[model samples]
Target chain A: MAVIDIRIDLKKGVADPEGNNTKKTLESLGFKGVTDVKAVKVFEISLDMPAGEAKKCGEDMCVKLLANPVIHNFSVTVR
Target chain B: MKPEEIRVCVLRIEGTNCEDEMADAFRMAGAQAEKVHLKQLTGETFPEMKRNLEDYDILALPGGFAAGDYVRAGAIFAARIKSALGRDVKKFVEDGKPVLGVCNGFQVLVELGLLPALDGTMSPVPTAALYTNDSGRFECRPTVVRNDNGGRCIFTSSVERGKLMMIPSAHAEGRLMSRDLDFIRKLEENDQVVFRYVRDDGGKAEYPWNPNGSESDIAGICNPAGNVMGMMPHPERVVTRFTHPDWTRNCPGGEGDGLQIFRSVVDRLG
Candidate 1:
C-alpha cells in the first residue's frame, strides 16, 4: 500500500483570512519578523497501489474535489 | 403548465438546514413544494421516498452547510450530486427549468458548476468559488441588492430593473472569486449577472455594504439561459414583511421584497 499526502492552500493572490489572523495572534505574542502565513488543508490517503499510481490518484482527487483550482493550489507527496 | 401544477423540489441533505423555509417560500407562492432528501434522489432511501428529478418543475437548493462544508464549502454535497444525479440536473437545465440556490446553497451551485455555465449546461469543473470573507468572521446583516439583469434572469423578472431590494445575508464564506480574466465581461455579455450589492439608494457599495468583498460587488448571478440562479442572500427568510431586519421601522407593509422572487419564478410556470 502507498500512503499519499496532499496539501492544499489558497493560491498566491487569494487572501487567507484564517492564516492571517493566526499570524496576527503570533505577533501579539511578541514573535518577531513574521512576513506572511498560509493556512492549508491536508488530506492523508491510503492507496492499495504502487507509489506512482497512488500519486496519480491523489492528483485526480485534488482536481475533482480535494482542492478548488479557482482559489487553491495543491501538492501531493507519496510516502 | 399552471402555477398550481408546478412541482417544486427543495432538495436537502444532512446539514442542509434551510429546506423547510425554502419549501415554504415556494408554497407561499402558490406551488406544490416539498423537501426531498438527497438520499431519496440518489436511491439510498426507501422506495416510496425515491424522487425523480424530471418530476419537479423547479429545484431549490436552500441555505445551510451541506455535508458540514468540509473539504471546502459545498464540495461534498456537490460531489455527491455530480455522482448521483448529474445527468438529471444537466437535463433539467437543458430543458430550461428554474433552479435557485441561496446562501450556502449558492456555494453548492458554484461547486456543482451550475451557475454561469458560460459554455454549456454545466462546466466539467468549477469555474468559480466562494472564498472566505475578508473580515475573517461570519457576517449576518441586512444588505441591499439591485436587480441588474434587465429581465434576463427568470427569478428576478418581477423585480424592476435597477430597483433596490432589502435582503438579509448571513454567511462566513461569501466572497465570490474566479480566475477567468474575462469573467465580468462574459457575465455582462451573456446577461448572467442577476443582482449586485448596492447602497440603499442604489449607489456603489463598499466594505460592509458590499459585505464579503465579492468581485464586482456581485451578490447573485444566473446561468446564461437565466433558468438557474445562485445568490448569497436568504430571500426565503424575507418572504413575509416581519422577517425583514427593520420591518417594524420601515413598515414596507404586506409582502416583503423577497416575495417577488418566489412569485416571479412561480409566475414563469404559469
Candidate 2:
C-alpha cells in the first residue's frame, strides 16, 4: 500500500467566511451542538518502502512537493 | 591559530534542521563547529555568549522551518533577535565579523531589516521583501548560482570565476524584492551582489534553475557590510557528491557543491 499525505491551511480570508456561514445554518436548523469549530484535514499514505525508511522518504516528499510551507505545516508517520 | 582550532557556532531552534550538517561541514573543513540553541542567544544567556562569540570566528544561521513558520516565517524569531541578541549582532557586524543565513536563515535576516539597503547604508526600516512566488507554489530544484557579487566576502572567496554551484532550494517566499537601484547598482558594480540563480551552464538565474521566478533572477544577497549574507537555497543539503542523485550519469564527485562556502569562511578567519 502506498499512502502519501498532505495538509494545507485554509487561509483566514477564505476559511472564516465559510465556517461562519455553516454556524449560522446549523443554528437555524437547531443543531447548536457544534461551536468554535475549526476545520483541518489530514491525509495518510502508505508507501512501498519499509517502515524504517518511510519517515525519511516522507520528509523528502515534503521537501519536494507535498507542502507549500508558506501557509501550511505537515507531519508524517509510516505504518 | 591553527585551522583545527578555528570554531564555528551554529544558532538553532525547534524547527531548524541542518545544524548537524553545519557542524559537520566545519568539522570537515578542519574547524571546531558547535550548534548553539536559540534560547542560548537570549538575554539570560547573553553573559555566556558575549565572550563566546569572540572565541568562535564564524557565526552561522543554519536553515530550517524555524518556529514552524508561525505568524509569518522568521517574523517571531526576528523579534527575538531584536529583543534578545540584537546588541550582540549589532556589535558583531559593526566590528566586521562574518555571519551567514541560509533559507529560513535568510528569512530571519530580512525580517530583522538587515537585507534591505537604504541610502547606501543599512536600512532603519525593512526595505527587502521575500513574498510568495508569483506562480503560487513551493519550488524545489537544483539551482546554478553565479558569484558575480561575492568578491572578497568570507563565503565567496573559494568560488572560482564562472563557477556554478548546484544547490537545492525549498521555500515558498524565496522571491527577492527591493526598490533601491542605487544600492543594487552599487552591489553589482562592487561585486557584492554575491550569488544569483543560473542555468546549469552558468547562464544567470532565469527560467528552470531559478524555479521560483525571483526578481532579477536573484538567488542570494549580502549586506552592504559584506559581513552578513543570506540566500534562499540550501547549500548544506548538497554537500556531498552522491547526494547529487546522478553520480554515475553526470556527477564527477569533486569538492561537493557547498564546501567552498565553508572553506571561504575558514580561510578568512585564519
The best candidate in terms of DockQ? 1
Q: Is the docking of candidate 1 incorrect, acceptable, medium or high quality?
A: high
Tell me the lDDT of model 2 at B32: 91
Give candidate 2 regions above 4 Å deviation: A1-79, B43-51, B117-122, B181-183
Q: Top model by lDDT, which number? A: 1
Best by TM-score: 1
- Chain A only, candidate 2, TM-score: 0.58
Residue B243 CA displacement from its true place in model 1, Å: 0.9
Per-model DockQ: 0.89, 0.02
Over 4 Å off in model 1, which ranges?
A: none
What lDDT does each candidate get?
A: 0.91, 0.70
Query: Considering summed lDDT, which 10 consecutive residues are worst modelled in model 2 chain B?
Result: B116-125
- For B1-270, candidate 2 gives per-residue lDDT tens digits of 677888778888888887898788888777898898767655356676533455567788888888887655776666677666777776777787778889888888877766744334344445665666655567777777877654655678767866777778888777775545465676676555777888887665566678767767877877776778888887777667866645557767555687778877777777
TM-score per model over all chains: 0.98, 0.72
